[model samples]
Target: MRLPFPSLSTLPPTLAKPPRYFPTLISHTSTTTTPYYRPLSRSLSHPSQPHHPQANHSTTPPPPSSKMSSPAPAQYVTVTPTPSGYALLTIHRNPVNSMNTLLWSQLQAALDRCEQDPNIRGLILTSGLSRPVFTAGNDLTEIFAPMTSREQYARFWTVSNQFLARLYRSPLITAAAIHGACPAGGTAMSMACDHRSISLHPASSMGLNEVAIGIPVPAKWAQLMATLTGQGEANRLCGFGKMVDAAEAKRIGLVDSLVDGEGKEVVADAVRWMEKTLRLPDVGRVITKAHFRDRLSREWEDEEWLRSEAEGAWEMLASDEVVTVLGGVMQRMSGKAKI
Candidate 1:
């Protein structure tokens, strides 16, 4: 059966072009209108800095790129402040915002900075661009690249788990504003947030399909799914690799609120509802989120279990069947892949 949405080759507006190098830090300055991406300065002392202590042991400046005599234009993740002291964190990774290792690291840094900033109260995770997809999910090219070794796969899980854990444990409220196909890791991402508000786009498909790729879902992600929809439903969905449309997702309680249109107005309505209906001081919001997420954390501390699980999953990915299936899907959509 043909999928309702076009293949990934047709780029959507949300996916930003690739960065020349991964950002060392991403900060949303309260003074600025958008989040800024910058290389980590040697003077930086915070853990939030994208410069992994393990990777950068020297003080030498990065060599200038010969490809560009001129500095590349600064790319910013759009941030809009809300009355509740929270800011909407829109992913502007133009075409489909498929999550990659570098983007995931940048997002981790961004969230860390958001948590530290006293001016920021919470976050609303959404796509800045109109979409056939909020996130097409993980960037399979990066995941299956020959350069991506077993160790790298393990490290990817470590970074991803920690990043997601931070989101779940954040003191501030975080809500996902989902619109289109939110599959695989994208589903995990939405579940990491405190709450979710999705648009009822008829084309939208949201679910976990790891099994179809010959991989088991990460333990933390599986637990989060169970927490949201209960053990029975989580098992049925994850086991069979079911993909549910927006209406079914809503009926099954997978999505909190589904708006009529896919536009800024829909997001505005949700933000307004959050401001008015979610009692302020935000302490209650934080506490309630913790109540649900603590269980997931307790099960995956240090992310040891998740790392081990992902390693095994990566091994399965080495199989021809898994590689062929995933590659064919991605290749068909290559033209549409975000630049």
Candidate 2:
């Protein structure tokens, strides 16, 4: 029996246009026989496919793109300050704000700016993408690309985890105004915040369901989830990679509050909440937050260890098992799109 798939004219919003951050591959053929081979857009020569262990031999993937050494975009995130003594840092890598090295660096910079500036008392994280998504997740291309070197993956991991560590431990009051479908990295960032105020829109949900994508959630992520929802619930949720709606999230402590509308209304509610919180004496809040969250944050502190972990990430993504699983997933989606 033929599986149901989207007609060519009716592609999903995510598949309609290629993601800018993860432009590691571009379709070069429509033939069903193209196999699961992914030709790296940057180094098409590699024409990489997972070296299935069952095969007698396979080609080694090439090094990362030369463009990696080039300067990244000056503004990958935008900082918009409000009169409410809070600033909104909109992840500006649009189409889908998949956190890559550039986004991580830019986000770190934006956070630094907000904290250093006397005018900004707190900061909120949101998305600049018009779509109802905070972020799809970390750009998987770094792992999936044929030209992805271990070093490159290491850099990507280090930069992103560092930013996340900082976000978790930020001195300024932090909040995530989750406006849409948040998964994986999006949920991690939201968890990093002091409060998660989410939109009640049906399109909005949150989860650490990286298992669905064949990704391993870092231990720290699960630890933080446990901190919020308790060890039993965190184990159940992360173990299954389940996504939860706003109501369930609020009830489970995955989210602190829910706003009635999406977009500006939700952000406004978060700002209002932040304003009220800012009224409290600042140092007490900061230190108290540190007391509870410091241990988890400290796990990501060592740059060297993170780099070593990145090698493991490279192995996981490029492994025979992950490649086969993710390949099947991509094939189904692309096949659906082509139909």
For each candidate, the alpha-carbon lDDT, in order, equals 0.65, 0.71
Estimate TM-scores for all models: 0.74, 0.75
lDDT of 2 at 95: 65
Q: How do the residues 217-262 of candidate 1 rate in per-residue lDDT, one tens digit apiece?
A: 7667787788778899889999988888878887777888778878
- Candidate 2 per-residue lDDT, tens place, 1-339, comes to 333443433431212332221122222133222122332121111112443433454465445678534653456677777767778887756666777777777776676556545556788888877888888777766556454677788888887787788788776789998888888888988998988988888878888897877877777788888989999888888898899999999999999888998788878888888989989866455555666555567677567678777777778888888888776765665532100
TM-score for candidate 2, residues paired by index: 0.75
List candidate 1 stretches off by more than 4 Å: 1-76, 145-147, 335-339
Per-residue lDDT, model 2, residue 247, is 96
Q: RMSD in angstroms, all models? A: 12.3, 18.2
